[model samples]
Target chain A: MTANPKGGRYRAWGLIVPTGVLYAVTFGIPMAMLLSASFARFEAGRTTPGFFLDNYTRIASDGVTLQVFWNTVTLSAQITAVGLVVAFPVAMLMRRAGPGMRLALMFVLVSPLLTSIIVRNVAWMLILGRSGLINTWLMDWGLISSPLALMYNRLGVIIAVVHVYLPFAVLPIYAALRAIDPARENAAASLGAPPWRVFVHITLPLAMPGVVAAFTLLFILSMGVYLTPVILGGNFVVTLPMMITDVARNQYNWPFASAMSVLLLASIVVVVALASALNRAFSPPRND
Target chain B: MTERSGSPFGYAMLAIFGALVAAFLLLPLVILCIQSFTAESFLSFPPPSYGTRWYRHVAAAANWREAALSSLVIAAIVTPLSLVLGTLAALGLDRGPMRGRGVLYGILISPMILPHIVLGLGIFRIALDLHIDDSLLSIVPAHLTITVPFVVISVGASLQSFDTGLEKAAQSLGASPLRALWHITLPIIRPGLVGGGIFAFIMSFDEFIITYFLSVQTRTLPLEIFSTLRYQVSPAIAAVSALTIAFSAALTVALMMRGQVISAGRIVR
Candidate 1:
């Protein structure tokens, strides 16, 4: 047992064993259990555990639930799209800035992420409040006579969430942009490719991987977000998380909540798999 | 190359967008700070007169003090625990001979991807089964699910770039494996640990869902602010929010500075 090559390997395994056990018990088993609980029925504080289709059937039949699902997908897609458009130019500017300006811009972008989500939501509430900043400014400027309904709506939730998640969107794109070789752009220019053409044909394609990664991250995050919707959307908008909350807490339907969670988890897995597949499809094959 | 002028239009567009984003980012904190100085009790935007009354009120509240204390205590415990566990996991995966290491890594990091509401529900059910629902002990473990992944990623990134030959050299010099790790590896990786620990601390401190679901008797600062926001819209809430924002900003700046120093040191070395 003294200093054998295999003995060192065993030692490493020994170090990892405890953590592996913790992850297995804490995360792995519980996730499997949750998946199973989804198909069962919980009624009157008693869960009848079995394979049942009613829960899935209920999800399909409920119009409001369907609408909420659609809203979640559409909102997530819209946010990802809009986030990319807004972040691209900013990232370009960031890439072109001096050292001090770059640091300042990074801080400005990252500060929103540092602020508590609840605080950001409250800020949105105040801004979208009838007498809050947006409406007040609009009214004062004679843009509109009456206060617009901004708070406790889908639009407000989207605005707040976009603001909250913009940093995530910006940083990745900025990294991708910065990683592009400036010399290549110059070469392309010398080869008679104009600035816009070089950007479209070369830079944008190189940065596509980051765009995909950012979109996937943002979309999944937006799908599962709880606080922004709860605070800003009120009862007007119902996403998957809100539905889960209603089922688990208000209705005391643990099985229903579990069902919703399973659906959410499955969709996320599907999205991630699709993203990876797309990435592989788009990635250039290595000679090695 | 043709003489091309600066695009004033582009600059103006960037400037205006930057200003709007800055306002969106900073106005809430500003409003909260100003409201904290208002003499009036309500959460009015424009204060008739300025005073430090709300700060006094926030400081005077025993519940606020207790919540803040609990938050500090929880963050203190959770941050170190997450750093150790996360670092060990990252190191083990980085160096281990495990089969399907990629899949294992994915599983390790999956907690971050899972909807926290789901995590909350799963943990709540488990806590109920274990009969530790609403205890600080239960809440600490729940927060670990979120914070540990951040630590893992940060530590893993550093570990990926770490030089292994130094450790081997120390081992060849008759230093015990543990001593080599302590003297060689630990110092090199200390910055990652510090940065990851700061992230873990913030994650624990600002956590709302797990604490909201798990804790029965103890409420962290975020939970307090959450409940306050839900039930009322007071200048006091604004004041508390302002303080939390400032605290978070300070921590972030400190972490960024530490990261810069570490990277600069790495470059110099």
Candidate 2:
């Protein structure tokens, strides 16, 4: 520690300045503009610079947008729930897997993340569309006379989204599971505690942090989903982001779009805060 | 890694469920790859016949080639720029003043969690006001907003396990501070750098939302794919998806071979 050069601390701090400048220019200023634009007046598709509450008022009174926002929230919760249920077993199996098996599992989970979202969704279209593989095979086998309404609806959107986001949920829970001390579980087992009881009492509580993390992340990521609902939802399921894009791009109503963005950001922050608070309330006291 | 000493029935059920989830993860991609080789012009699964015609179509298509090229160029540029910025930020947060380290770390990593739509709209508004909406000048910076966070995170993780003593020993042995860092520190953290760089390239290359707002005439690969999918479901998209999947598969192998650079524990940390 005594090998420090003169003013090393100053120079060390200086290293961050470049990125700081870049973030300030790229994110900070634009965010300020977004906030300001949210309050600006918009009349007849023309965004004029001024303070106004019409945009917020419209969102509050416009029953359709609220419904869409609620739909987005519900969709996010459903996706998170499905993701957690599917991912937990995979994570457990991963923990029990050999090194080679673990690497292969990681490959399966992470490769989907590396591919573009549209590409993944395109794959889903081929699988889940009304005339997709499932429907085609079912019809061919005479299992059903008609193609199931598998896609072009909310179910399709949820399926495709879950496929894409499942890894995001899995990775954290797996990490959490891996971090658990093996001795505790062994001790519980040695005490004649049943396997199910050991899991529910010992392992599950320890992994709550990871579960909470996964939930928060999946929910946030899901809330911002725009492309999936558009491509997979067949435009039938309108989410908040889709509505914002429509308002901004097609309607040329920047103020209104900004207002919606504000709403989306606010909701995300609120939900994340609530999740952390609930975790705090329910989590057993940490030994650390 | 605790072995879950579950009941036989429970173990059997868990393994079955796990295998099914794995298959579900791979099924769409396998189907899409199969569809890419169809002999027919239209999109169909378990194709009546197989051919490489769609692949050849994508190869010969001018717009597809241009879009792919543009995406590569942007990724190539954004990769190094974000790498340097992110590495510097990580180095600073690791070795610099400790007064606001937690706050700084959170700020640097926040972009990764922020919804892309809000960022896209914000940048789009800025580009419009500055009249630079349809150019690389606007798009590159927008891409950086998201990509830099990945570098900071991955590189920071590497730094967390780094041995500061090596750099100190070098300094004590008469190497300058900067030289010690350059020789002793950077080489050991190369895995993190490589991992972060790969993430940066992929993120920038696959980035669609911000670029969707910023570009009109200059279409990246994802933008091209989006527009193509919007118009009609074509076998050509299957070809493109297959190619991207192949590329990702290759990257995944490369990352795994690098020995846990993208490990779940490191990422969650």
Candidate that scores best on lDDT: 2
Q: Please state how well chain A of candidate 1 matches the true chain A, as a TM-score.
A: 0.91
Tell me the spans in candidate 2 whose CA falls farther than 4 Å from its real position. A1-7, B1-4, B261-265
**Candidate 2 interface CA RMSD, Å:** 2.4
DockQ of 1: 0.37
TM-score of 1: 0.91
**Residue lDDT tens for model 1, A1-288:** 126655565455455565566666567766777888888877677889999876787888987777877888887787778777777777777776677777777767766666778877776776687777678789889999999988788788888888888877777777777777676667777788866787787778777777777777788888898888888888787788888877877787777788888888888888899888877775633313
lDDT at position A285, candidate 1: 35
User: For candidate 2, lDDT tens digit of each residue in B121-239?
Assistant: 99898889899999888888889888898889888888999989999899889999779989999999888888888888889999988898888899899999999885357999899
User: What are the C-alpha RMSDs, in order, of all predicted structures?
Assistant: 3.6, 2.0
Please, what is the whole-model Cα lDDT of each candidate in the order they appear?
0.75, 0.86
Error at A89, model 2, angstroms: 1.3
Off by over 4 Å in 1: A284-288, B1-20, B230-232, B260-269
* Candidate that would win on TM-score: 2
